[model samples]
Target: MEDMSRLDNACHRPLRSAAALGLVAVLTAGCTGTDADTTTAAVGRAAVETSPLPTVPPAQPASQLTRAEVETAVSRLDGVVRDAMRRTGVPGVAVGVVHDDKVLYLKGFGVRTAGTKDRIGVDTVFQLASVSKPLASTVVAAAVGEKTVAWDDPVIKHSAGFTLKDPWVTRHVTLADLFSHRSGLPDHAGDLLEDLGYDRSYILDHLRYQPLAPFRAHYAYTNFGLTEAAVAVARAAGTSWEKLSAEKLYRPLGMDSTSSSFADYDKAADKASLHVKTGNTWRAEHVRDADAQSPAGGASSTVRDMTKWLRLQLGNGTFEGRKLIDADALEQTHLPHIVSEPPHAPAGRAGFYGLGWNVSYDDQGRLKLGHSGAFALGAATNVTLLPSEKLGIVVLTNGEPIGVPEAIATTFLDTAQTGGPTVDWLTFLGPIIKQAAEGERSPVDYSKPPASPAPAKATSVYTGTYANDYFGPMTVSAKGGELTMQLGPKKQRFLLRHYDGDTFSYRTTGENAVGLSGVTFTVGSGGRADKVRVESLDTTGLGTFRRNG
Candidate 1:
């Protein structure tokens, strides 16, 4: 089996903080005085007065952009973005930049797919991924503003079926805790359930089986927690999360092209095709339908639409002369709720998780809020907001595992503030991007032969039906001198090859089935394998299945 631990680590590591800016300042003064004291005293005074120690001045606030400056910045941004696409091999990208109440730049570049004539435009829809979190949180904020729900209300009050592994946490988890990712569930705890054809309700009910971190003790990014919160918001509002977001946020902010449904994406005339680089070329890839986890990361939108959303954020919940939500309630979503350990961070700046956004400080010591989203191999999206400067930028790319979005956002931020690029973003991000690309290219290695030549007993002894409560069923049988396993309702079958002692490996033949993986079967009485464990993409831990009949 491929090492799934590395894949999990690569896909879901906590986002790094912004890079630190280098600034230096010095202060010096000279004083000459006739001293009647001894020579030692005079020497001490001179030493203290003339020493040239480096001092750092308080960070200067970012300046607003003028019309002419905005034009120049956009022109420069166009070149930088195109350069990023070329260097990263991203098929297409759409960028939006909002400064205060105006959108200074909204445009797209390159073709929507590799080896295609379809041109990308500002209105082309792309999956927003985790960037959808803030939008969903905004809907919940609206519910709070209207007194339909309270942030502190126990989740069980709204969703009667809600439960967690711990009885105390199940009873005590709050709406705010859900949005803050502090519900105690491990990171991506129920992701495999979702991948195994389980519905949202089914996944929520099975949360009690998953392990938990101490409540609010540490940060564990979970999509199910947010999905639970969205369910509660929808229940309180007497509408689905999709409808609530549309009526409350999308329409109010004039984001007409945004949607929370995959159906809408299919019907849209202008949409970006999802792509993934294979070796040296970009190829089309299937976009995973996120309807089951809509609230967590399932929104699709255009740059033009997102520019309007940015304006509302900069306006503090108001947009186009309308106050869509109470300022206080909306601000609550932006307030830091828990500190996060970012792998990379600016000097003297710490990172935190707000209601739905990752909050950090810029080099200028100003609040910077943003989120990045990766749709497996499909795409990568990034949204950055500098509240103090009233600046926001959104970048969506069709081909990923690339750092193009982050590099572009950082470059835009630096350019907008200083009117020129001060960082070598591409060079700095090259190694990281290369590492991610290599991971994608080589998901599994099957070249090396297994240490053991055969199973403990005859292959026929392993043939039987195995079942898991959450994943449904798997039947093992010998066919043509090889062991084969069939999974779930689809009955997707993969030919198993003996890897070692009691271990076997299988390469998934169906797209929806688990990827190249391995399984270990434990022999019981009479040399029959009674228990089987799987190591695949859907699970980080070994999932055990017991022989049934």
Candidate 2:
């Protein structure tokens, strides 16, 4: 197995933060001199500074209000959202907050469609996009709760026609592998629109001829695998995936405004329009109907509906008068089965992975279980549950510029904390980072190397700035018989050596033992490095970087 832990140096971890109460003291200490003379002189002094000292009021007593108080403060948070929508080019957003089994706040802002005068409301339906994963995953959990499907059931057992490029790995792949995103396949393969073409069955049909990864590894999010998992859950439940979600999750949770389509969503009367930002303003774009990829990104819902779903999770999978689902199942969904370290996460540490949710810690190091999604030029969404505080947040936007979902979710939850409510995800999971090393297996990539090399003449076609709204800036410079890559200040002075026809590797200058564990660079026409791919240690996963020069 390739050791992904080696690539740990490629990314930086989030900064350590001080607790809210500790922040003031830390800042004060930093400002005050630490010299022995200063300490000696102040030995008999009062805690406060000398007389004419500015009367900085004592920190306001921590509010002891109820959840309703927190909700009310959050409800009046309209002004706090302008910047979030502005940065993401989203014209409107629907926000919801839930504490345990109750909906604390549900509201909307801006217009549903930018060109139109229609407004977004609490009941306005918008594309849930990848938020569908949780719902689809919930059904699978329900099936497990009822013994209809085993979490470890192999894909071939559920659907005999399935096959990958490698026959051996195909038969052995389990349903959990797909949902957990370790199934060798990447997010969307060659010309996804051409294969699936807005049709679900076609995607399943093409799965038979698709390639597989030799070794299942850590998380690399994939829509195809999750969709397959959704189908398997449907087959196990003896019903269609759509029907299963409606009956088991939607109806029981009273998510009347949620569905897999704009048509079905309209039944609720009040719904949000899908908007795409166009230079400074938003315009109504087609609602994403990637129903073919429904398991990955296809539900339409509102803040209220999502809040209700949050309550169910908070209530241990039961809602109102019905034990709609099992609490243990919900626990299973949040419990980390695989140790994964996603970007922006602390280095040399592995976070847990549930069925569809990527489990991690909030700024305070509290466990946070949630799933975030984005649709190209459509919308971005985030739903998070902090079980310890029995609090959750649902943030939906009609536009996305990457990272908006995570930012919004964090901001809202942090804001909620200021008002009497206290919810955290980590406190419930007992030292997740220190858990056992299970060495979970992910999908294996078996694609063969390219046939022949391109003509050998180089140009400066690689010199320019390529930006991914999420990953940050990548700069490539070539000079003095060498090419170098600078990914946000971290410079790589290395020789670009060719491997396969389109692939190349890097050898750091004057550095023998400190070589990059694994890296593949692809030069396009004109012998220009147009793509840079860092292979995961397992070689089954990928973090692809396209040439933007």
Candidate 3:
């Protein structure tokens, strides 16, 4: 309800060929319960890269269909992609749909490179982007399986040197709080890894030297904390996060093509190209390998490998015969641990956070376990399953805007569950949004205790382009007693009104800037804003932007 326009979908795609596939397995349409037995589905054809799929005879009365019907379904999906791409500026997208145990459809639309005509294939390896979050969750679960750590372990316990600006809060911060984004940090607007590409040690060094918010007060997604958590997991297990991921996840599930870095895919013969949105179009970009924070958003893979991951999640933390992790750990990871504001709540009653995933209840009150991730040029990738519906969906795309991935992924799930009656994706989402709309809450009246505005002062101490390895360069300008910030193309202005000691907010914006508002002016012995720390609304990735100009 709070200006949904800011959260609009940002990209689009095209369509490809279709093929006939063979039936591999059969499943009955019924709500799955604990008593329900797991069923196996078959491997269709070699692998259809394009859609307008050749239909195989239905294995169940519910799925029985003529080739034409299957083609029609695939064709409809093609329109969905074409329209989505055109509307959202998505350069390339690869989609995989699974019904029951079978991957009923897989297709790529557009091209690996926008103008090169390198047609995307089902096996195209797009950076899973933030899709790495769920995978990270899996790694944590594996650590639990190996008895490497506990969910409730305080994060400070794992890394003795880790601390927040507030000493007491640092000791209380838990691993669950970090991964779940309940660490009270705001989403650092720019890419932490992208900007802070200084070195692998930069994150730790920054944490040791920087100040952080209280451990748990609000929900702000922090990739930095998560990356640290990943490092902690690695250190605890005496292995790198990537190796642990491969051993505990990829190897067990036979996702040989999947990896925690782009280098891994580069060594392989087949992988999709990376692209970025430019002036309403997707342009080719060099694939990046994340040496630092590999667990945050560095995993890359094809639809084929991802499907195996889906199967593992559907099987409740197991694949084939291996109990990769305790089934209870899966439940624990999915259990909502914190309450948050409406629509974006943590995990229970409404929105909530699981250990490393976002757990939401469907209209039917059944649990839908999933998380969404976004990185430069890619976004909103997710794998979601309704254990009750026995359905799962994986949506991956090449361009990053907003909501595009969620729209497609959620649409697929809606279609799969409804058995495809052809509902407009946007129209279908309307009711869900309406249901989620809390109408605006009344504005807070702070008259009882009038807030004291920060003293107006200019510290010409540092004002220049500050560059970090992950976030690139941030330009700061001080003029007319106002400070302005420029990151890439986006710009924001702030008025340094006082709060507590050194914090301030936008001149006019109120609580809307809570997590984002507090801009702290670091003082030197002379009492000047020598090193200013720019705090945003929520500390997801970027907690405090330090002044180095």
Task: State each model's CA lDDT, in order.
Answer: 0.67, 0.53, 0.52
Highest-TM-score candidate: 1
Whichever of 1 and 2 has more TM-score, that candidate is 1
Best-fitting candidate, measured by lDDT?
Answer: 1
Q: After aligning candidate 1 to the native by TM-score, how far in Å is the CA of 17 from where it should be?
A: 13
Give all candidate RMSDs, comma-separated.
11.9, 17.2, 13.5
* Residue pairs in collision within model 1: none
Alpha carbon lDDT at 54, candidate 2: 17
Could you arrange the candidates by lDDT from highest to lowest?
A: 1, 2, 3
Per-residue lDDT over 265-342 for candidate 1, one digit per residue giving the tens place of the 0 to 100 score: 778888888786777888886766777778877889999999898888888888889889877777777766655543
TM-scores of all candidate predictions against the true structure: 0.84, 0.62, 0.65
lDDT of 1: 0.67
For model 1, the superposed segments whose C-alpha errors exceed 4 Å read: 1-71, 342-348, 433-446, 508-515, 537-542
Candidate 2 per-residue lDDT, tens place, 503-523, comes to 445532210011332345566
